[model samples]
Target: MSNTGSASFLRELNPNRVEATKREALLENPGFGRVFTDHMVTIRYSEGRGWYDAKVVAHGPFSFDPATLVLHYAQEIFEGMKAYRLPDGGAALFRPDANARRFRNSAERLAMPALPEPLFVDSVRELVRVDREWIPRTDGSALYLRPFMIATEAVLGMKPSPDYLYCVVATPVGSYFKGGASAVTLWVSENFTRAAPGGTGDAKCGGNYAASLAAQAEAIREGCDQVVFLDAVERRWVEELGGMNVFFVFADGSIQTPPLTGTILPGITRASLITLARDLGLTVREEPYAIDQWQADAQRGKLVEAFACGTAAVVTPIGKVKGRTHEFTIGDGNLGLVTARLKSALLDIQNGRAPDHYGWLDRLF
Candidate 1:
């Protein structure tokens, strides 16, 4: 719903494309964000002119000045979504309009110009169409698309850039984590908070991720796969994982997650899972969950299952939790019935293995 007028994209094919044989070999075992497609989409925005000069060109890098605003001030935001290989031998995207709406929200929060929703979807459509051959048909594999915006103006002052670049690049991805769907252990961070009220924590920005790396490193040192953050004010409530939203399953067939209060990212996948869980007639609650209460519930068998959801990782079961002075395992430290049911329901519709009753799939030839 942005005011930027319609953009007419110009296509420019890649002069040096990988041969089909090599491309096939790459797609066979293409891990997450490692192997990219041949082409990409780029659109520019100026303070006065709005969005302009849209193009689909060969995949490559850009040469920017050292004073580039994004490099110095970290004015950037990005979204991750996927294109699925359908059962009928076609490609489709899941919930792109939702991504577009979130993208605009991120732009506004970062003091950047908004791109029209139609242009955003059209740009993705163009790039995916140009590189449709790269869509992988393997289980849990698809073309992962990264749409991002960066402040491009060269300056030294601390302010929003006049020039910005919006681009979409895709990679053939099989799994986000090396463990695949196997359960992951989380290290609870009492020292670091992900976002505070009136902060960029709710926005999908580069700074927010950069802020989590230190806590993530600490987790890895503790032999954990990921880091989970607590609320900034209290440091008692569980907010979210470093990059994904978390949900807890109880024995009564109820689901609960940390609410969105301008401090947690409102994940599209998390929203979808909430809907699908409720569709099964289960009660899903969006409320504050304390870390100590979580461990207590898990120990007493009140919490049966817990999982994290996002675009790249999909729905990942969280098995164990570790902190400075406490450690506990959830639901026998294995995938539970509720987690599996929700995951299957989401992935089945995504991969076209089952009927899409919600009309979530936007199929492409």
Candidate 2:
């Protein structure tokens, strides 16, 4: 992974921009990821040239050959994060450097050239700086940033591509939990496996998400909000939800989550929760949690809360776990105290309402 800090070069595009009047109309009810900002960042890469052609340009589509490797082989990866508008009229990115590092890790895992860390940060900052006006000021809202890389090589071979393209896009988003942070229902999948022992679960790749859509559709059809996947090998140990990591809160004030067992995404929110829990003087553990344990604990009043964490939801309470033969309801089927406290603490830090004792926020504009 390249540790370079910032890009040495940047170019501005023509000022023929689209006005935000129509966008503002959408922002009033900007239900997640529906409306996009006017600008985007892009950089190109080849074996000999490395990463080049860094620029901020108008938001538009790109032409790709029919034989593009990504279209055929699915050689792509991406990262999701947010930029918050502080009350002081400035913008901040939460743990952006960590995202950069994880982006590089995802690139390396996919056999793609890693963009220099400096270039990555520079692209994000430049885009957010230009589109700072799009950062939503309402509570529980943010400017969602998506950075992605795709193999652009027009070849038919099964080998890795030598050419790639990296781009960043932003969207104004509202709270993921539309009504409120109420408890959610989950569907347990016994017929599908999200990842294997040596699979790309450790990387945030498009294919991983694409593979989960069928299971997710099944969950929704069964009247559940999300699908919980188990380990691919044994299909017993708990893994994660479709797009988020899982957490379990005990009645004794302790917390636990499934470990990074090479079949789970290492979420930034997951890591932050561990730190926050430790700071709150709660004992936290990372281990292999079984689905049966959750059901048994809820039955015995030992497991008080269950939630999922990611960039989109931040933190969401899990009220019920529904499987083929059993259904379990946790802690009166409502949000628990530990879950509420952790969510508020993380939000406060991101929104500049609390002290950033860990320096997790980076001022971009």
Candidate 3:
């Protein structure tokens, strides 16, 4: 399976597919990642063979051996992106090349084989093409794509596995956060940290999310919608949410976000927002923001709006923040002007409502 080069995937379509009626019923309210398409893309990788045996096959479970390396050592990586529905019933992918580059970077960080970026993009394109019908017809609805790689060698070792299995699966999704465009409350975790300076925090891997479940549960217990982690070193600087990057909007029309200083996952949506913000002639700064400062500014009306961004969540406004003994609400405790404007701009480009000046859409149909 070690070919490291671009290879066309063989087609093995699903025969016992779901009828359009049932699929349509499911798509009507596919909350998120619940209803999947019929087929998935899979590619095999070996130590010396690189990547091979690429194909689109029926979506189902794999019989994992008891001694699978991924089960033991947890050497795995993944990427998340979406194929949006176009005006003419076509579908377009947003910044797939960026997702591909990030996938390669995540694989390298996990000590796994570097899957060729072209192959990664191709796998996603092929999967969406095969499951185009799975894409929702609504403007904001989409077919969420998950491309992942895991060490498949059946060995009881602590080193990197020689065999890997790469697969791409599609799910019809509406909104990531149930709150939708409404502002969300965040619970600051004083007891836990998400990522450190020299950690896998920047990589799109399962381990990071696995480590965040406890804090997320704690947030839910504290009556919050999401968990925001602080810097691992001093625990004073704001890092990011469990799965999204955050941005702060000031009353002076300036925007700031925690810098990508090797501790935060560089989100594709985050980058796009920065570009769009700059295009709007608003000053954008990548700097460290402390929790105390956030509360103080919000209380004094210096900070007007804040939002979290990611491939899944897109741009979600942050209205309230709650820590151990402190809580403050952003401007009016509602969706701020800047937040709504940016979200509309981003969704417009994604759903083909506005001109894609940045050339971000990769048309799939």
Candidate 4:
């Protein structure tokens, strides 16, 4: 067998496990990204040695030098996925292979070495297995897994690191929205642009998210839940929110989303919902949507619903939109039928409450 085989990786476990009582208590109210599981997975990569030292160890802080390459040049990438406690009390992952592939893409874009897909998936699987007890049992809740890679080389140059660390840590999370599943209002950010052509917007890197924080803070200060950014070139086309992809449902029963044109992040949730919508017999369109057209359509009742989708939020309805000069409400500013139906369908499949006709779930236990 290969040295880095799944069995070898599994045998390297040294779990500093969390106490059952404390873990259970945290699971009871595990807010998003706050509480973590007992164990984490780590693998090291070097220019000559390749990937080595794979292990599942206790979750804790890492020793980082002040001049670490990632801190200076930001050579890092990450993927967000979840492990669900099924209705039958088993554990499963939702399209982890997809995440593995995307992680490779992000690594390539950021000038980082791509960890083998099998290794990536196996690392996540073993960590989730060791931390299975941390999976939250609350409804609309799961163990949110974050797999990230960072350049660990202690250099302050403008080049990629020669050494890297890939790690996976999981946190049991409750509903992403604090109070409940209510519609949200969005603030259009005409002043800031998320990404331009031939940029890192499509890559799932920390820099892109860091660039969006100022705009997101602006939205929060302006009495909005999220900020919607436009395309960088024209500044008129609707792109996406800070961390999620936007979808619009028209009055004619057609669903539209901004195309993945190297400027917007290709969201896994957005892609899944597109397939699910088509399977439900709804027309799915991938085209550029303009901010002004969104305002006009919502005002004229042509746009029935608008929602954002991501790994964290899943499907969130956009009720009210506020721009500098234009403002409108979509479909009575409530959760539209299409939005609710799509959300329920995706969640059902994810939680294993519905039949796995599409074979999306990877049964881990």
Q: Go through the candidates in order and give the C-alpha RMSD of each one to the true structure.
A: 1.3, 1.7, 1.1, 1.5
Predicted candidate 3 versus true structure: per-residue lDDT over 206-288, tens digit per residue: 99999999999999999999999999999999999999999999999999999998889999999999999999999999999
After the best TM-score superposition of candidate 2, give how far the Cα of residue 31 lies from its true spot, in angstroms.
Answer: 1.1
Q: Estimate each model's TM-score.
A: 0.98, 0.97, 0.98, 0.97
* Candidate 1 Cα misplacement greater than 4 A, ranges: 1-6
Candidate 1 lDDT over 1-365, as tens digits, reads: 13454567798999998899999999999988888999999988888777878899999999899999999999899988999999889989999999999998999999988888888888888888899999998888999999999999999999999999999999999989888889999999978889999999889999999999999999999999999999999889999999999999998889999999999999999999999999989999999999999999999999999999999899999999999966999998988899999999999999989888888888888
lDDT score at residue 128, model 3, on the 0-100 scale: 90
**Model 3, position 311: C-alpha lDDT score:** 85
Q: Give each model's whole-structure lDDT.
A: 0.92, 0.89, 0.91, 0.90
Give me the displacement of residue 146 in model 4, in angstroms.
Answer: 0.3
Local distance difference test, candidate 4: 0.90
Tell me the tens digit of each residue's lDDT in model 4 across 259-362: 99999998999999999999999999999999999999999999999999999999999999998977899999989999999999999999999998988899
- Pairs clashing within candidate 4: none
Counting clashing residue pairs in each candidate, in order, gives 0, 2, 8, 0
Give the per-residue lDDT digits (tens) of candidate 2, residues 58-139.
Answer: 8789999999999999999999999998889898999988898999999999999888777887889888988887888778
